[model samples]
Target: MSGNLADGERAGAARPCLEIACDESGSDGENLTGGNTDVFAHASVSLSVTAAAAAVRETRDRIRSPAEEYKANHLLREKHRAVLEWLLATDGPIHGRARVHLMEKTYFVVDRAVSLLLDDPEGAVTLFREGRRTFGEEGWRAFLDAANRLLRVRPNGDPVEIFYGTADSLARAHPGTDAARILERLAATRPRAESYRAGCADGPPLIPVLNPLLPAIVRTAALWSGDGRPVTLVHDRQNMLTPDRIAWIEQTARRAGVGLAGVRLVVARDDARVQVADFLAGIARKIASDELNGRADPALTALLRPYVDPASVWGDARSRALLADPVAG
Candidate 1:
């Protein structure tokens, strides 16, 4: 195992090599409202398997419990604060960077294709016109509400400009055109709109976990791929994420031109590195949930914020910049 890592590192001189351990929290998937966890967070750390295992082992020993199991949930207690502090400490021996993708489930329940709409200016205009005609002023208000939400929250670049420009152009072009006609035009020309129409029969297909998961992978890979070395990812196992999904992620990476060495799955208990990933994932979920509820714990926020890759963390300026990157597009 050490030899493999060494080989990877040496090869990385020509192309960087990154070993990633990943874990998730609040992953109830399509059944978001049915679960206690209202957010989904995919967290990862970039480090060799050996170093990450050592870090986890060292932290577990510091906790000083004879129990064989040590999970992120255990660290929520006051006594386990040291474990969190140690893992995120700059001088700590963890020897890696941490990044997480946070999805507020409620936002999705409100509108699953928010990102799609943001990218589809024509769709936004069509919805706005239809909404106004169907429910009078109230309907237009609601459509605008949803659209504004997407514009404000989406990581995509300069959404306000795109949204306003498209909407204003539509209003001017159609003038007093009938809402039904506008819908027909949108259905004919807007591929996303057409796709949604075709798929609506299936009840707006459940937003796959991979939607958020893939973005996280892309962002992380880009951040760590400074030297163009291959990135190898190992994610904590989930029954729902079958082999097909793994294959899809790999294929997507290939299409995106990401140098992916491999993708592996493992049980958290079997891999100490994955346990460290669990800790980061759990913390991210907590912070995102707290911010959503307007009850962010300052101390917890303070502890994790420094270690978090601001460019990858949702809602941060650095993350917005990443969103603007064509590669992410």
Candidate 2:
């Protein structure tokens, strides 16, 4: 595989390729607003097919279900708690080999609205960081709700109309408040809404704003390519990873100095590694969502801690504290 030279490598030397299997849980395509899941998780694992299959077999041996194939739900059952623990244990096959990127769906929509509509991404992030304090909890939720409606692309709706309508409603609802000020700032970027609408119309019809999978894939590639090796992702078949999107991912990663050789799509049932990745992604999503809702199982949360990527796009104070505190229950 070809990639940028690693430190201490000869300039023209070929870089080794690291093949990773990937799958995601809670993908609702661009429907992050009212999707079945509150969290989106993308997982990648650097394990050989044999190793992955062996792990799966081990899980099956412990669970002993009659199903032809196993899935994350099988492991997530209350009766299979020990099996789940064993899978996430440090000595487990997946421990150091897997990484998961989790995105809280609502937080993702808010981030997209801020980054797309505001001039300074950093400033937008800062505004969001202090959003709860600056605006009351109700006001902040109102702002997020507005942002979610504004960014959600509807087939028969005008983007500019949606943008102005949402902004006006939010401003009216929270007049003389920080939320209203943020809405004003967002309204100033009306042209961006028009441009985004035009781009979507001119393209293969993809939601750059609402889809978290695209960024998650790029992050996963970069994480696996840290050694300067080109990463070849063997992913489960996903409609969102179109040819144009894959090309975009590669180009974007290259610009960021990541060596993404390419991505290969395969059927999950046919790929054992991808199946293992599905388990990791699915389990991580469940644990994280539970934590966010204040119904966390301490044992499961502790087991899930290590697999979560540090760059996960979670905005909840509880999630932040859990990730930051090693001894957190």
Candidate 3:
């Protein structure tokens, strides 16, 4: 699997460009709070179409499942544990060619709220890291719930009213507490919400903090473009990547000093590389979710460690500990 262009093609280029296939799992758009899945995993793979197809064919031969399309679930069943281990092994086809960004949904909401509502987002994040120890679990839960509601964009509701109402409810529920103080600070940012509403009234509605996919895509582009090379991403077709959103992603990447050549959308079934990425993403999400729930399989965890991106948006101490574990590497 390689991303190198032909020498003739490279001759006229200012810098080398690599093209990679991408797919995601557990994507519920901006519905972070009421979404079906708690984890979002986006995967990118550098494999060529032929190489990816061969890998898939080999896996299918090993599993011998009758299904027309292979998915992560086929590899996850207990009966196919050996095949799963082999697929994720360091010596496997995807070893160094893949990357996955796994985010815990609740944590993402908290992070977004802090960034949007607080003056010192970093300080607020550090304080919130103490979790139930600093603010009682119930109080913390209430704050997160309120924040999620305030940030979401509804088709028919007044966002400004939702903002103040959410903040007021939290203050009433947990008066004089740390959580309430946070909500008070958030209420002070009512002007920001008003600005958002004004902007929405003028143009397409914007919920900057709701969707996690944009940031994830930016980070993935940065990772693939680490050598100062431009990256062209081939992704599974998704409704969220509208023309405006794709332009935003490209502009954001440029601002961050990453050279993103372009983004191309294709049906996963038509593209073998995208299919391979789909499998990797789905499996990674399930494994990460299991780890979050304290039901991780040790062997699977070890196999998955190499592909987990270090900058993934995980906000729990257990998640940090998992990343720090030398044995898993």
Candidate 4:
């Protein structure tokens, strides 16, 4: 639980990377006519130290839940439930102690990035444009700091890398493609990254994530992103209990070309597989304690405060529920 992959392997640990890939899809096919939302899944196959096919299956067996199988419909529903509860406690207007704690932690990440980016506004432009730079010298330095901070741990740490899949980075991987274009428009509208990058505020990389094969609603979005780097595909608030749907999403994700994972929460709109409200709410429930008396400590509060609700036409009812929960948090 506390070592890097290499260190764990050296210690003869059981599972190394804990690679979990999750995909989300609907009967409506992930776009356009948005009726009949069918399924979503968090499919994970853990490979063990033996590095054999048998180990792979074993890993899959150990981690695979009835809710984590190829059949995603049921899993999808359950996950949604879990996410909904989380949203209610943490981000709901009323103070859910554990929910606030998670929000505060979440905000730190954005705050750290924004601080670095805003340090030298002019410098950011030159580093990005003039040089075909993958993290310019300054950027690389910042990257190292961010990476270190992100990977570090403490007592009662967040075990899951819940937000691994990044949207801008993903779209950039396949620039000029349909998905990329849609992401571009999303970049303009989505403020997810604004808290982190000043440049993002100008022409943001946080764009609408889409599956290119779905030809139903093809809109022009930002095409150039990530600069063709390896970006992880994060499925937010996924519920995949059905094998058939899970299989379809697995295949679809592969066709799109990116690593995927099942994340409990993410911004609700766009292609983010999960809902941000749900994730925070889930964390609220997970960390809730009678001793805290419904008030998340500074640490817990830090983790949950930053998540803003991403609502569609009707907005999110899930976020409101957290507020109604009894506050022995």
Which candidate model has the greater lDDT, 1 or 2? 2
Native-to-model Cα distance after best TM-score fit, residue 4 in candidate 3, in Å: 8.4
Among these predicted structures, which one has the highest lDDT?
2
TM-score of each: 0.64, 0.86, 0.86, 0.21
Task: Name the 10 consecutive residues with the lowest summed lDDT in model 3.
Answer: 320-329
Which residue runs does candidate 2 get wrong by more than 4 Å?
A: 1-15, 126-146, 155-159, 202-207, 324-329
lDDT accuracy of residue 300 in candidate 4: 38
Clashing pairs in 2: none
Error of 1 at 3 (Å): 17
lDDT of 2 by residue, 174-217 (tens): 67766567776777787887787677667645436788888899
- What is the per-residue lDDT of model 4 for residues 1-329, given as tens digits with 9 covering 90 to 100? 11134543554444322222222233222222122321111111111223323322332353365533222222224344443333334433222211121112212223333334334333333322322234344533333233223322211222112122232554466566543443343345324333333342355222212222111111000010012222232333433223444444444444655332222233234321222222333343333321123543444333332321111011112322332222221
**Could you tally the backbone clashes for each prediction?**
3, 0, 0, 55
Candidate 4, which ten residues in sequence have the lowest lDDT sum? 216-225
Q: How would you encode candidate 3's per-residue C-alpha lDDT over 71-167 as one tens digit per residue?
A: 9999999999888888899888899898888888888887886786675666455545754454566756655566676666643456567557856
lDDT of 1 by residue, 265-288 (tens): 888888877888888888767765
lDDT of 3: 0.79
- Candidate 2 is scored at a TM of 0.86
Badly placed stretches (over 4 Å) of model 4 are: 1-3, 6-19, 30-33, 38-70, 73-329
